[model samples]
Target: MKLDRTAIEALLPHRAPILLPTEVEADPATRSGRALIRLDANARIFGALAQPALAHELLLEAAAQTFGIVIGACPPEGGAAAGAEGRHLLLGFDEVEFGPAALDGGAPFELEVALEQTSGPVHVARFSAEQGGAQVARGQLQVFNG
Candidate 1:
């Protein structure tokens, strides 16, 4: 399924500034997804730090939101409205690597996320981000759904 900003807003709890991706494509059956984020000077991250590079925390949040979209699109059996009523928590991160900084120049970036495993309300996903054909970051996110 393809999700726009409105759909993303409906699915995610995050609002403007914090909300990252402009669009997303998710395959619920395969539990895989991709998202596109365009960062510009107006982005909150830029305003907060006034740095030329996108912060690592923002990248991580973007990955998390992308995964959230995937899960939101595919609600489990008897699960509530995806993330509507559920609480998604970041359990931890594994083997996270931050590559070259992403400059705030209205450049677009892509994020890919794949489900690694699921145990109860906990879901593990591998994610990576790329900008200008170069890797920006990668990590495994352990998320808990409740």
Candidate 2:
């Protein structure tokens, strides 16, 4: 399924400037997904910096959001939405590798995430970010579902 900004906003708690994904593509069955984020001046991380670039933290957030899209798409076993009540928390990052910064040129990037494992409320996913078909970052995110 393809989700626009409004639909994405409805599924996620993040608001604009921080809600990075412009669009999301997800498979509820496989629990894998990809999200597109177009970096512009409006991105909060840019602030007032003359030359803005995609920070590692922001990339991580994007990855987490992408994962959130997947989780939100596939509700829990009982049909309860994941993070519907803002209970999901990013527990940590593992083996995170940062690449070249995405400058403020209205360039679009893609974040892809796949479910790696789940231990109770802790969900682990592997994620990667790419721009112009080149990898910009990769990491594993651990999210705690409440």
Candidate 3:
């Protein structure tokens, strides 16, 4: 499923100044998705610097939120939606690496995430981030969707 910004707002509990993922191409069945975050010089996370850039750590946030989309959009077997109202939390990261942004000055950041494993409320996912088609970060994330 593809989600535009407005649909994202309805499903995600985030607003500007911190909202990531301007768009999403998510599939619960596939347990994977692409999340895109586009920024301009005036974007809040980067402050008022002449050129804006999202800090490396925030890329992890994008991964987490994108992962949430997959987990949250699924229909529960006999209950509420897997993507139902719940707390999505970051638990840990592994083999994560960061490289310099390919496009500076607040360009678009895209994250491709695939769910790796899950046990009850805990989930593991691997993600890679790219800007201008160049990888900026890659890692595995452990999260809690409780």
lDDT of each: 0.79, 0.77, 0.74
**Best-first order by lDDT:** 1, 2, 3
Give model 3's TM-score versus the native structure: 0.82
**Tens-digit lDDT track of model 3 for 1-146:** 88887777666666455667788898767678998866452246545632234466567777877787666665534657666648678898899998774446467888999988878888899999988888988999998877
Better of 2 and 3 by TM-score: 2
Model 2 over residues 1-146: C-alpha lDDT tens digits? 88888888887765555888889998776778999876563356546522254466677878988888778876665667654534578888999987765543367788899988888888899999988888888989999987
Q: Which structure is stronger by lDDT: 1 or 3?
A: 1
Query: Which prediction has the highest lDDT against the true structure?
Result: 1
TM agreement with the true structure for every prediction? 0.83, 0.83, 0.82
Tens digits of per-residue lDDT for model 1, 1-146: 89998898887755566788889999867778999976553256534643255456677878988888888787555654554537677788899998866544467779999998988889999999988888988999999987
Query: Lowest-lDDT window of 10 residues in candidate 1?
Result: 42-51
Listed per model in order, the count of residue pairs whose N, CA or C atoms clash below 3 Å is 0, 0, 1
Ranking 1 against 2 by lDDT, winner? 1
Residue 132: error of model 2 in Å? Answer: 0.5
Alpha carbon deviation, residue 21, candidate 2 (Å) = 0.1
Better of 1 and 3 by TM-score: 1
Clashes of 2: 0
Residue 52 error, candidate 2, Å = 3.0
